[model samples]
Structures are given as structure tokens and as C-alpha cells.
Target chain A: MTIEIIIQAIISGLLMGFIYALIAAGLSLIFGLMGIVNFAHGEHLMLSMFSSFWLWTLLGLDPIISIPITMLILAISGILTHYLLIRYILKAKMIVQICATFGLSVFLRSLAQFLWTPDFRNVGNPLLEGRLEIAGIFIGQPQFYASLVCLLSFLLLYLFVNKSETGLALQATAQDRKAAETLGINSNKMFALGWALGLSCVSIAGTMMSNFFFIFPDVGVHFALFAFVAVALGGFGSIIGCLIAGIIIGLVESLGGLLIDPSYKLLYVFLIYLIVVIYRPQGLFGR
Target chain B: MNNNLQKAKLEPVWHTNKFIFALIFFLVTLFFFFPFINPSNFQLHLMIMIFMYAVMAQSWNVIAGFSGQISLGHVIFFGIGGYTSSFFYVEYGITPWIGIFIGILFSSLVAIAIGIPMLRLTGHYFAIATLLIGFSFQIIFQRWDLIGAASGLWIPLNWDNPWLTLQFHESKIPYYYIFLIFFLLSYFSIWIIYRSKIGFKLRAIRDDPQAASSLGIPVAKYKIIAFVISAIIMSPMGSLFAQYILVIEPERMFDIEISIIVLLIAVMGGVGNVWGPLIGTIILIPLSEYTRIFFGGTGGSVDLIIYGILIMLICIFRPSGLISFFPKKILERKKFL
Candidate 1:
């Protein structure tokens, strides 16, 4: 009711917004790169969370400290996915393309469940803990650090995408695969790089989330759905659009939950995508 | 060049000769007496499952395969069929037979509303939009308490007049026969469409809407028609499934997994053909059912893993689906073919 509570909500929403943007980054990148939705994108998130959790458990490393290792692990899996599954289906029917990834999603989720039961596991006592209150606005330390890391990663990714030569070639390939190939760019390598880069984004997001979110085989499912909405609202392949849309979603979720019913919070997030679909099928920022 | 290609596409269907008709009749007759032999209850259950899924997949084919717009959220109509029927039946004491019609009507209206806008978007956009809509429905139905909320709805056990209520406690045979009839009717409808101009026009849109529109086809009208047909096929089955199981949960009914399974059956068995869904269900259902029966007790998800792999392998190796494995000579029209 008061301005202080609304301010608190905005601050908290902003922090979670960064994480959501980070979570959506990889999905947007892959879709922009190859036009494949990566139905298993959520499973990749689940895997990265598990990887970070296990790293913490077995190696006695803090989730933050093991971010690089988890990113590496996820990047390799991404490379493997590109080589083993995606490349073959890239030119196939739409249904084939959809099913191949959908199957991979189902396969990976169950495999994770089979290997490490579906029971939720938490990273207890991560290096980040406690809450900070500044000017009557409360922020959890873990959420703050998570947002800070996500923002930093997004900036780094932006640089790599825009400033780097390989990134430009990647963009060229995404614009037109055959044209890029004619220009001596190996579309295959670009695709592989896209996968590695995409999964790495998921890994970073997952590692950050591991500090606060429960680690489970199905944990990524929720994030994956949210990422879909973010990608759609932001326009596929638009990084800035993703960030803005993610923030909007985060604010709407928090405000909707506060002003209305909590259980129906997700309804508002999805409604935004529906609105985007009807009014701007090209997405809010899509060309 | 285009004319020849069009001829080629149209010539493959319409093989309705006496022998083929007799063969189909013989096979249907054989299947009709199948339950009379008193097969094991498990086998009967499997057949029923196959018929149910076959019909669903074929229904989905009207939109996805023929029109070439994949709706990953096809389960929404199924959920609509189920929730509407069960709510009326469980609360108002309305018979499911009438409820089924209402469910069908609801789904058709929903299809018209959703299809007009969504069908305009092509390929991935359509798929993604439908998927989000489907998820939204799940969330809505899960929270709506009038239909039992998340706990789901169940028809009180009323075996007194099972026939009227669409619930038969006497045997699984009645369900099997009913489902078989549904399957045959659905197949017949699809078969009729397959030989009709609407089928050709749909496939034309599937290949290229621009080209179809250039030919003066009412692209918009046919697309919505396809969507409505698909919804109509899927809706009643949901009601029947609810009646058979005597339970209707929003989560189970609206799960994306159901959509995936239906797509798998249609795609792996050969889409763009009348027999594709039946072939897909016959192969997929039993494998999944058996795997779950044997290896799923510990919640291992072994069946799902296998199911996933099978779909991937089939999609990669046989993207045209298993029906293509048959001799092309036999599939084509003219002579015995």
C-alpha cells in the first residue's frame, strides 16, 4: 500500500529480472543463431544446476567459485548437442526438428532423475548469505550478487557478440546460412560455437541460481517456460530486448503478486507474451 | 514442372478399389471380434490406449500435418473437452453423452478464437504461441476451484446404469468397443478428407501458403477450418477418456508430454497421410506401456528415456516416418497400388 513497499517490490523485481534475462539469454541466442527453439534448453539449465550442486558437494567448492567449471561442462554438452543431434535435424522437417530436441529434453530429464533421484537438493551455506537494507528497501544478498553477476555476464556477452570477429561471422551466419558459407564462414563451426555460448549462458545463470534456488531435475522446467516468454516478448535474437522484457516480466510478476493473487502471478507474465503475439508477432523489438 | 508435381502429390491417394476395401473390411472385422476372444485385461487396456492416442494424433494431423502449422499446445482442446464435460457431469448430473457434445462445442469455439490469430503466424511462432497458451490454460484450470482445482474431478462410482453415464464397470470390453468405434469414425472422416479437395488444398498450404494463395484458394478460411477440425477430433476423445478413467485432473490433461506423444505418433508413423497416426500409436503406445510396467515402478523414468531416444532416432533416420518404409509402388495409386 505504501511507497516503501512498492519500492521494495521494484528493487527485488529488478534483481530477479537480471537472473531471468540471464536465463533467457542462451535460448534467444540459439534461436537467433539457428532458429531452433532448443526444447531441451530447460534441461540444460537443470544440468548446469546439478553440475554446480555436485561441484559444491563433492569438490567442496563454493557455487561462485565453480562457475567456470560448470560453464565449461555445459559448453561441452552444448558442443556435443550441436554435433550429435542438432546438425542432423537442422534441414529436416519442422516436426522432426521439434521432436529431436523434445526427445532430447525428455531423455536428459529422465537420465538426470535416474542418476540423481528427483528429490530436491539445496546448496546449504553458499558463500553468499543474509539480507541488506538500504533506505528501507530490503534485498537478499544472494539475489543481489546473482543480479550483479548476470549483468556482468550479459555485458561480456554483448561485447563478444558485437565486437568480436567470430561473433560478427556468427551474426552473418544467422542472417543467412548459405550466404555466410559462400563468404567462407563455416556455418557448422558457427553453430557449434552458438551452442557452446548458449549453454554457457545457461550454466552461469544456473550457477547463480544454485545459491538460492533448489536444485532438482525439474527445476529448469519453470525457468525454461519463463525464458520462452522472455524470448518471445523481447524478440528472438535481440539481447537488449530480452533484458528489457525480462525486467518487465519480473516487475509485473512482483507487482501482480502484490496487488492481486500470488498464485496467479505467472498468469500476467504469460499474458504479456500473448499480447505480444497478437499485436507484434515480430516481437516488441524484432525487426 | 509444377503441374507434374501437383499430379504426383494427388495421385498417391484414392486407392479405394474393391480389394483394398475388402482387405480393410476384413481387418476391421478381425479387430471387431478381437475382444470377444477374451484377451488379457492388460492387452485390452493397451489396445484401448492405442485407439485413444491414435484418434488424438489423427485429429492433430488435421492441423499440423495437413496444414503444416504445428500447435504444440494441442492439449488445450483436449483439456477443454475434459474439464467441460466432467464439470457438467460431476456437478449437474448431466450425462457425459451430452457433455461430450458440449465439450466438442466448447473446443470448436475455442479453436475458432485461437486459430484466426495463431494460424496467421507461421512455423515456430505458431508453435511457441500455442505452447504458451496451453501452459496458461493449465495454470488457469489448476487454480479454478469449481472444477475441483488441482485435486481434480472424479465421477462418483455409479455402476447402476453404466451405459447411460458412459461408465461401464462390467468389463473393459465395452470401453474397447466404444473406443474402436470412435477410432473407426475418426479414421473414416480423415479418409474422406484425404481424398477430397480440402486435403489437397491443405497440403498445398503446408508446402507454401504464398503459392496456395496465388492459386486463389481461401488460405485463411481453410486454415481455420483445419484448426477447427483438429479441435473437434481431439475434444470428444478427452470426454471419453475422462469417462473411462472416471477422473479428470488439469495437470494430467494439459501436460505438454501428451502433446509430445501425439506429435511423436503422428510424425514417426508418417504425417500427411491418413494411416500415419494409427501406425504411430500402435508402435509407440505398447512400447511405452510395457516399459513403464516393467521398469517404472521405482520412478526410474526408464520408459520415457527409451521413448525419447526412439523419437530422436526415428526423426533423424526416418523423418518421413515408418510408412515410407513400405514399397512406394504399393503406396501409389493405379493397379493394386
Candidate 2:
């Protein structure tokens, strides 16, 4: 491959990586706060994409314009999920917790199929609908805008987790639930907030990608698999680690597809995941 | 000394209970043959499916339930078995009965190879790694043209000689009886293992690996052994599945859904018990079949929805599984009597 082509692949991969980071951030946050791996995390993303698709098709609202509504819906659903299912299994065995979330994932996917008919739908005549050329490199406008949104959301979440009082409370609860409760932080509320914030990040990603990618009930499976690898590669509870790992996965996928057959793209991503898990299970940025 | 005296007094009662249990089991086995006496093809097909799933679930229970290693990627063994047997039969004209043994050996070896490295990780890491391995295997099989790639391999239908090919021309009875034997063999082996010294060590590892190791238990060795045995038992069902369906594809054979179904069946019936998967198969296969037959747009959606709800409820309210309820109730009734 030419240097220019390599650079192009790198840029695209980086952009896709940002979106992947957004998708994985919620999963990492949930694991960090509650120590529960939300297998339904991908289903939440699928739901948000469907919401965006529906809003665009029915009201002629641009996907960009429906971001807040989609986020609000998903955030509420996340909170409901916490209260309805997750809270009950907080003290349960590890396998029980895992199966509960897995069951929820199955329920959500089938429910989506029942409601939406499993047809792949994409937003038509999206607001950002062209390609941009920057000094001999080409980029899709939708992808660029999606990456921009990803960066902004990541920064906002980082600031929220690191700079705010509520964020501090969430972290305290995650560190030691009983200690946080003793300090009158209401750990339950903090957990609910974690779910809200985590799912909102997924919502933004789903909305942004709705413009370019096909939306379907099972659309989240591949992305969810990638996000799991990213979360693991980044370490279980580290947000920055997830972002970096997500980008790395994206780059590997794009470069691997370019260098080798596209069919082996997932092979490269999984190889990196296995290597990281074996050598550095704590992740790149994890403490 | 008093406890030993009481145990000796109760020995005859325990022996009689054992005899009764065995008699009941024999009767149940006889009952299964009733369907064969005057079988409809559809009913026989469903029976085969139930038996196939029961074998798969029982194998899964060995690792996940007995050893407490929650592997979510067991479909890889199933796929390996299907692929191996089909390849042997298609290429060398080997009988599926013989081919299945080779498939079992192949799957067992792969399980040991994968288990050695994977068993090093604990809990969720092990689960996720196995899942990724399964996905990678599916992707590789999909891309490899030598194994038929995405189009998959098909076992040609030869009606001339049925027994040699392990194919019956018009009688689903043969398939049912074959799978019934598979189920019995799987259950009997697990039953023996559950009562053995190795089974005690496996349960010890499951309950507390650190304590087990402190007690001189070979924790890793036993776990790998359980995993390999589970994989070996799982492969034959895959082989039977291929012969029954007359085709095998990467997507269908290595699908994550198959893994989830097996897991659910084991969990729903009662994990760690020999009868758990059998009970689970009995309850689930019929429910799923009826739901699919009656409610028809894509068929699987409604059944999956119900299954999902049932699983969540079971996990939350009855984590010990439905079978636990029965034994307790039976014990209570006996006490009252």
C-alpha cells in the first residue's frame, strides 16, 4: 500500500475507534461502579439507533437533531434496568448476575425484532451527506461528524467523572460502597447515575452512527463483541483505557483489512485482545 | 461410634431407595420407547431434538455446573465435531459411527489445548476469552474454502445403504433411538463421575479453589480434565445434528445462540445435577417448539422473548433452578408421611 493510502486507512480507523470508545465507555463505567458486566450494553446502543431511525423517518428530524431525545430515552431505560433487574442481583453470585444481564440482552433483542420486524433501516438524506477531502486525503462527512461528537462526549464524560462532585461520589461508591454510604452519598443513587451516564454515551454513539450504518435488532452483536474486547484490552474499569484500546482495535481492523483479506479483520482484533489479556490484564491505562 | 451404628441401621433403607430409584429410571427409559411404537415423523423429529439438546446441556453442565467454570463458548466443540465427522464421512466414506469417535478425539484435544491457556484466567476473563475464541473459530471456518467456506458442507443423501451411512431413508425412529442412546451414555457417564473421587475434587475446586489447593487438590488439572470431558461429550451431538440435518454450516454450527441455548437449558433445570439438563430439555424443547409452530413471523422471536423473560426470572428468584424445588417438595412430603 502507498503511504498516502496507509495514512488514509489510519485516519479512518482512528475515527471509527472514537465511536467504538463511546460505545465501550458505558460498559466500562457500569463495570467500574457496580462490578456488573452489562451484556445488554449493546442492546441499549441498538435501541438508541432505532430511536434515531424512527425519529428521522417519522418526523423528518435529522439524526443530529434527535440526539438529546435519544439520550434521554436510553438514560431512563438504563436507570429502569438498574432498578428493575440489576439491583435485585447486586449481592447474587457472579454467574447469576452474568446470566441476568445476558437474559436481558436476549429479551431486548427479541423485543426489538417483535416491534421493528428485523429490517435494516438507515436514516435517509442525513444532514451530513458527503465526503470531505483534506490535502489529498478523503473522509466521509458523516464519519467525521460522528468522530467529532465522540470526542466531545468523551471529554464531557471525562470531566464529569474527574471534575464534578457527583462524579467524585460515584467514584467513592465504586471504591467502597459501605464507606460511601457512611458518608451519606447514597450509593444506590450513584449507581443509578452511573447507569444513566454510561448509557447516554452509548446513545450518542448510536445516534451518530445511525446516519451511516444500518440499524437492526442484531446490529449491536458485532459492535458489542468489539466493545467487549476494547473494554478488556483497556482494563475492566478504566475509561481512558477503553478509549485507547478502542482506537487500537479500529486501527488494527482497518489496517488488517487493507493488508490482508477483509475476512481476517476480526482475527487481528481478537489477536490483540488475547495478547493484552494474557500479558497485561490490567489494561494500558488502568491503575 | 453412635453415628456409625445409626448408619448401619439405615443401610437397608438406603439400599431399598437405591433399588427403587433404579427401577423408576428403568421404567422411564421404557416409557420413551412408547413413542417409537407408532411414531409420527414430526414427533420423532422433536424427540431427536430434545435428546440432542439434552446431551449438549449435560456436557455443558460438567464444566460449568460441576467445576464452576462458566464457559460460554462450548459451541466450538460442537462445530468441531460436526465438521470433523462430516469431513471424514464425505472424503473417506467412513461410517458416521466411527467418524464420531474421531470427532470426539479431535474436540477433546482442542479443548485441552485451549483449556490450558484459558484456564489461567479467572471468572469473567475466562468466559470472555472463550467467547472470543469461539468467534474467531467461526470467522476462520467461514473464510477457509477447503472446508466449503460460507456455503458449508452437505452430506449427500444416499438412500441405497442406510445403516452404513448412519442415514435412515424414511424412519425417524432410528435417529430418535440413536440420540436416546447418546443421552443415556452422557447421563450415565456424568452420574458415575459425579459419585467419583474426581467429582469430589471438582466440587471442591468449584466451592473454593484456594481452599481446594490448600487441601492438596490438583485444581488446574481437574478443571482441565472436566473441560476436556465436557467437550468430548458435546461433539457427538454435533455429529448427530449434522447427520440429522444433512448439512452443516459455520454460522449454524458455531453460532453463539447454540451456546446460549445449552447454557440456558442447564441453568433452568438445575446446574451441577445429573438430571438437570434432562429435565431442562424436557421442559424447554416442547415449549419452544409449540411457540414457534403456533406463533409464526420468523417463529423464533416469540419463543426467544419468553425464554429471555423466563431466564431472568429464574436467575433472580430461583437461582438454584426448578429441579431444586421438586426434590425439596418431595423430601417435605416424605417427612410429613
lDDT score, candidate 2, position A77: 92
Displacement of residue A253 (Cα, Å) in model 1 is 1.4
Query: What TM-score against the true fold does each predicted structure earn?
Result: 0.96, 0.96
Instruction: For candidate 2, write residues B1-337 as lDDT tens digits.
Output: 6876566445543343454477657866775765757967877888888889989999999998889988889899999999999999988899998989999999999999998878878777888888889899999999889889999999988998888898887878778878888888887778777756788799899999999999999888999999998998999999989998888999999999889888888888888877788888899888888888888657568888888999899988988778877757553322111
Q: Write the per-residue lDDT of candidate 1 for residues B1-337, one digit (tens) a residue.
A: 6875566556655444667788888989988999988899999999999999999999888898899988888999889998888889888999989998999999999999998877888877788788788888999999888888899998888968888888998789999998999889989888877667898799898999999999999998999999999999899889989988888898898987788788878987888878878888889899888988887577648877887888888888898889888788777653332
State each model's CA lDDT, in order.
Answer: 0.88, 0.88
Query: What would the per-residue lDDT of candidate 2 be over residues A32-146, giving only the tens digit for each residue?
Result: 9999998888899999999999999889899999999999999999899888888889998888888888889989999999888898888889999999999999999999999
The residue pairs in collision within model 2 are none
The DockQ value obtained for model 2 is: 0.74
Looking at candidate 1, what is the lDDT of residue B272?
82
* RMSD over all Cα atoms, model 2: 2.7
State how far residue A13 of model 1 sits from its true place (Å). 1.5
Candidate 2: deviation at residue A166, Å? 0.6
